[model samples]
Target chain A: GAGVSQSPRYKVAKRGQDVALRCDPISGHVSLFWYQQALGQGPEFLTYFQNEAQLDKSGLPSDRFFAERPEGSVSTLKIQRTQQEDSAVYLCASSLRTRVEQFFGPGTRLTVL
Target chain B: GESVGLHLPTLSVQEGDNSIINCAYSNSASDYFIWYKQESGKGPQFIIDIRSNMDKRQGQRVTVLLNKTVKHLSLQIAATQPGDSAVYFCAEKSPGGGATNKLIFGTGTLLAVQP
Candidate 1:
């Protein structure tokens, strides 16, 4: 209810299956982010965390794309073999620092069938 | 490989008029600038932020303008309504110690609101 919540909003993966996306921020909100939206393009930066410490992932576009925030408020963005350009929409944001202003969720479309 | 542009991708306003969205950035040691509003499936809603030493910034009705010597950035929505439509992004951040603040998005400008 505070904000930032995501999980299985819609996933169809099958190409090479292996998908796990979940984010639940907005509690302590140190900092957590993962973005990748490509249906019209906008969000990109696909990795960042400051609480559970992940630092950066160079924008993960390969290596099967993986993300974790362990306990800093919850975060996980896995996508093993899935293809089809890895489908689209997959976002999760939260900020209380890093210059501030950020709180989002409602994203997780990923469809690679 | 840095980009964030929009000479215009789509912008049709009418409701109450007054809407200007344009952004062009290529990093000049960017120092924070944001304006987002996406509504379709939801996400991105910040809507105003400016700092590169601040050229202008006003919220609520929305307003953010940062020039940073020509890097350019703008977003102003006064009366435009129809829920203000959606898809409008312009973000950038760089110039810090870095643990990865990374925010560099732009390439969005679909704000069709006519009523």
Candidate 2:
């Protein structure tokens, strides 16, 4: 079975540019989560979705950050006006409906210069 | 503001030796704990998990122990291998939220296996 996967394993963007990171969760997974991991640090929760509904966006750092999961399958994390501070690895995870055990993706590393 | 943290920044052990990684959490109300292994250039991979109800749980070659009385958690790996060398992190379920599934992760401990 295929695990969660993210696209554009590496990305380099100029400051103030917009970037979109995509995640494909496992088939039939009902829960999806996004996290940000800075260098030498653990991942921090960013947002969460249950099916197509966005349930929690509390962890998003700023208004420039946005996420959506329409059709209950694929999710996207978009960062507008990228900043140097936003340079980090963005990780996506999925789990069976509301379960605590989450399967993670390889993550997309975004480097803002 | 509760947080999770590791006791050591790095641990080096010989291959085939037993390895133990320690973690401390601030929230006593946290009930669920998990261990994850992350290699360079990859996301976290689940190793094992234990709930507050159980003091200990085991998986293939890996074991997790939870001490609720002291708000401590530990991961034990038997007969460590080079493939097991990576960053290990302990995570706890968020205590008070409608979205309790969100996890609070600790600063990872790097496990270096020397053959």
Candidate 3:
């Protein structure tokens, strides 16, 4: 079975630009999560979605960060007015409705200059 | 301020030898703990997980031990291989129920397997 998949394995953007990262969770996964990882550090939770409903967005660092998971399958993390501080790997994970173990994607590395 | 942290930044071990990584968590209310393996340029891969109700759990070549009394966690790998060389992290679920809770991750421990 295919695990979670994220597009644009690598991205380079100028400061103040807008970037969108996409994630395709497993076929029937009901839970999806996004995380940001800085260099030499572990991933930090960004947001979570259960099906098509956004359950948690408290981890989002700033108002420029936004996410949505419509249709209960695909999810997107969009960062408006990108900043150098936002240069990090964005990871996506999904899990079964009954399990706490999450399956992660390869992640999209965004470098803001 | 709840957090999970690793005892060592890096660990070097010989191939075929057993390796153990340690973690310390601040939240005593944490009910679930998980071990993840991440390779360069890749996201975290789940290795194993243990709930607070149990003290230990094992997977194919990995074992996770949890100690609620000391708020400690450990991951033991049997017969380490070169492929096991990667960053290992310990994550804990926030104190609550439901599978949708966010995870608090440790800084990570780099496992270097020397053949």
RMSD vs true structure, all candidates: 14.4, 0.7, 1.1
Preferred candidate (TM-score higher): 1 or 3: 3
Model 3: per-residue Cα lDDT over A1-113, one tens digit each: 88899998999999999999999999999999999999999999999999999988888999999999989999999999999999999999999877888899999999999
lDDT of 1 at A63: 91
TM per candidate: 0.34, 0.98, 0.97
Per-residue error (Å), model 2, residue A89: 0.1
Q: Which regions of candidate 3 fall more than 4 Å away from where they truly are? A: B96-99
DockQ of 2: 0.84
TM-score of chain A of each: 0.32, 0.98, 0.99
Query: Any residue pairs clashing in model 1, and if so which?
Result: none
- Please name the candidate that would achieve the greatest TM-score relative to the true structure: 2
lDDT of 3 at B113: 100
Cα error, residue A71 of model 2, in Å, equals: 0.9
lDDT of each: 0.85, 0.95, 0.94
- Per-residue lDDT of model 1, residues B24-109, tens digit only: 98868877878888999988888778878888988888788888888998898999999989989888874442767768788799
